[model samples]
Target chain A: MTTNKSLFLIPKFITTPSQNGVGRYVCQLQRVVLKFCKNHGSSRGIREFIEYDLLNFANKNPEVVVYLKPRRHRGPVIKAEYLNGDDQIVFCHNNTREEIAKWLNLLRTQSGNHDGTRLRKLWHTDYPSIQGPWTPYTFRDPALNLAEFPNEELSRPLDQPKTATEELDELFKKQQESEVAESSEVK
Target chain B: MSVLKRVQQWATFARIWHVYDATWQNPFQSAELLKKYLMGIHKPIYHPMNDCGDHVIVINSLDIALPGNEWAKRVYFHHTGYPGGATWTLAWELHRKDPTMILKKAVYNSMDGNLQRRYTMERLHIFPDGNVPPELMGNVSNQIRQIRPMPKRLDHYTKEEVEKFPKIIDYPKDYILR
Candidate 1:
């Protein structure tokens, strides 16, 4: 229910490049730099991630280049660069070791810096329709293409009820037929 | 974008031209019907923000019927910026001044008053008769049906057809014809 416009105001787009895992998989995350202070209290999560999970992560994805920068008293930060020239920074102040591992995984999988940006559409396709897109003439009567404009046959309403004059004419015809039958029986 | 995709975009958003015969059709009723085509509400891809409306050419505006006593009772008001410049015109009087005004107003008032209303009205083309210019008529690909059936007059029947019609009562030979 928050009415903040910052998330909504960001440019929206669909994934265009790096259609990975179809025939070949190329990891877009080129390099990730983990910045943290050795003695700061906020860098406890970073220190824990480096001890328990950093070696496993580096061995799993040898394509990604990981660099550690130990500052004097700065907070923890993760700076990731993509092959598509997108640079993203995640501030990990007071974050747990588990949260830091999840953030690194998300950055490795994404094609670009997609944080704070919205997806314009949920669906994407190379061939949008198998039956082709609709045009004005789709399902239109072929006879109309040859017919002239303001045609009387086309102008009349589709459903027309019997008029009073036609009803009266039908009644008179029935009466005449009954009278004729009576005269023929006498003969 | 590919060449085929660019052409597909043009085909989907093309504006269709429609012709409607207003003979014996009530202006108010026809307005509601025409409003759909004028604003592209009848299409499957209709969106309030999209510019997908079509052009409507109305013929025989002079023959449009007004239900009940609306011709006399309906009042159209107008005013100038200055004082004592207000005037009220009856529907019949307005029709007499401009044959297409009544129908035009009916359609104009049928839609919601918004910034797009004026632009939507610009696509409507009204003619008093069927004598539309060749340029406009050439673009018409579809015809909108009339709301009511056109009543047939006695004179419209052929002489032989009228003579052969069944009669309920016969006049005496001695009785003179009027």
Candidate 2:
């Protein structure tokens, strides 16, 4: 077997246009992944290190590790690359929706996260203030298969992918209502 | 809460200086050159010895811009390891949730790996709304000028907008400098 080179694309801290608690979870992830990668030794020959590389690689390899934080850490840390399916190993932190989608596509499931999936499913469905009701569009997905995407939506000349932003807004409204209802029930 | 005191302001005595708006800009998002620029980097100060301080007062800490397509897709994670395990949130959502967090993150990231970076970094002040504390600035209004992120300008005029009019294209009788 021919060996390939590994690369790194580590984003330090990720926050949004909205004010949200980056939460302690992502902070720790940044520390762990950076510290771990910093300590690990990497050889040469790495090429085209990017998200595109990882997504394609993951789609081709089932033996790849899909880590979403709950019970497992994302992996195949041994050697990473865009070629030879080396990009399949993703070191994602901050639990972005794209990462969730990547793992979901990799595991081929939606919503119902099994005990051992790539991403660590957050228990609190209600993400702090702004992190919830997952937004409708994302750019990075290590396991997104274009064929599985919504063809019906694209049947017409599409200008941009329309998201369920209104739906999410409604979800937040409902969540707020439920919270108010629960508070009144207790009162 | 409350911002820390401004500490001290040293007089400008260098040939070159830089200004940054971390509030409206991602300190880390700058290409390699911007980092070198902010660090007082492109200087012939030569020796890697002492610290050469520069002033960077970012206004409107709540409105720093981010790179393309990242606002919605990217998420930040943290893990406390309770039964709840890890937590994740998109950057765009954070802005909607709390606008100030992103700017602070940018300043920190921009200054990362710089020597004496922390001390120099603190000199930056960021606010929730787009407000700059002019009182602290005194008559230094010139120094407190708003930092506009360098926009890419195309200097090349289109063929239609050029001075190449039929007769005007001929050599001008005299050239004048603006």
Candidate 3:
């Protein structure tokens, strides 16, 4: 289920393997949206789109459990702090918790719009590494607070598990050793 | 609290992609803006866990604008890694030589380390004219629902050329949802 009210459509530019391309594309794209919003009254048009969609959906059926594919605990990506070898760093977020809280508060406080989304029922749309057999995390953020962003642990040090290639190499080595032993026994 | 929410959840898991575009004073500025638009950071939907950006289509690559004499002065570097294998070309050379690859290459340079972004970028379409060929139009791609930058007939570029750029041609607004 989804609502037009506040689904943050962050365009993760994973189209090209080249890092420069992603940045270049993002930069150009930002300008366009800025221009569009400027020409079309920017956020106002967006607000209108949201109101129209929500009202339309509500009219059809009052019960709407819209699942938003939003960013995880949108906060600051602070360099991980390792405390007593108990470093709890996770994914690297762009903003810190304070910044996120500030933005959320600011967006919510503004009476100009259809009541900002305000982190309503958060969900983390996972993007993983290419070589990774991505480990699945639960959709429901148990620690999520409607008024608050996720804790600073948003930027976690990605302690990657055994990679696919590494695992394959290990398997190959074991097989090779077994074959060698069998040959030696036969000889 | 039913098993069906899982089914509903499964049904709801959309393969949602992003779409971004820009019309610059010139291709340089256009490509610059287009880069940011496709990256999804511009949108509120950005997620670190998942790269949430969409498929971007950059029209009007030929007319990209550059600051000052960047077109003439800006040089792109390439390394062969063999003695004196390094080569360089000015931005002007690239645009004229291929034109299509200039903006694409510019963007490629910007996205340095993100390997996943490399895949999501396949959705991007860069055309010199507003009227791109039919194949480039978003209508054909099931993932691309609408053509943003709304397909205008830029100066001298034909409507046909614009249509060619989008995956869909003569598509109704409701075509994708239907």
Superposition error at B10 for model 2 (Å): 7.3
Question: What is the CA-based DockQ of model 1?
Answer: 0.63
Cα displacement (angstroms), candidate 2, residue A16, comes to 62
RMSD of 3: 32.2
For model 2, what fraction of the real interface contacts is kept? 0.00
lDDT of 2 by residue, A38-102 (tens): 22123110111223344564555444443312222222122122211222333434334344345
**Can you tell me which runs of candidate 3 are displaced by over 4 Å?**
A1-187, B1-32, B131-178
Model 1 chain B: worst 10 consecutive residues (lDDT sum): B161-170
List DockQ, one per candidate, in order: 0.63, 0.01, 0.01
Q: Tens-digit lDDT track for model 1 on B7-38?
A: 98899999999999999899999999999999
The CA lDDT of each predicted structure is 0.93, 0.41, 0.44
Fnat of each prediction? 0.87, 0.00, 0.00
Give each model's clash number.
0, 31, 102
lDDT of 3 by residue, A85-160 (tens): 2112222233333443343333322222222234433443344334433111224344432312111232122354
lDDT of 2: 0.41
Worst 10 residues of 2 chain B by lDDT: B4-13
Top-down TM-score ranking: 1, 3, 2
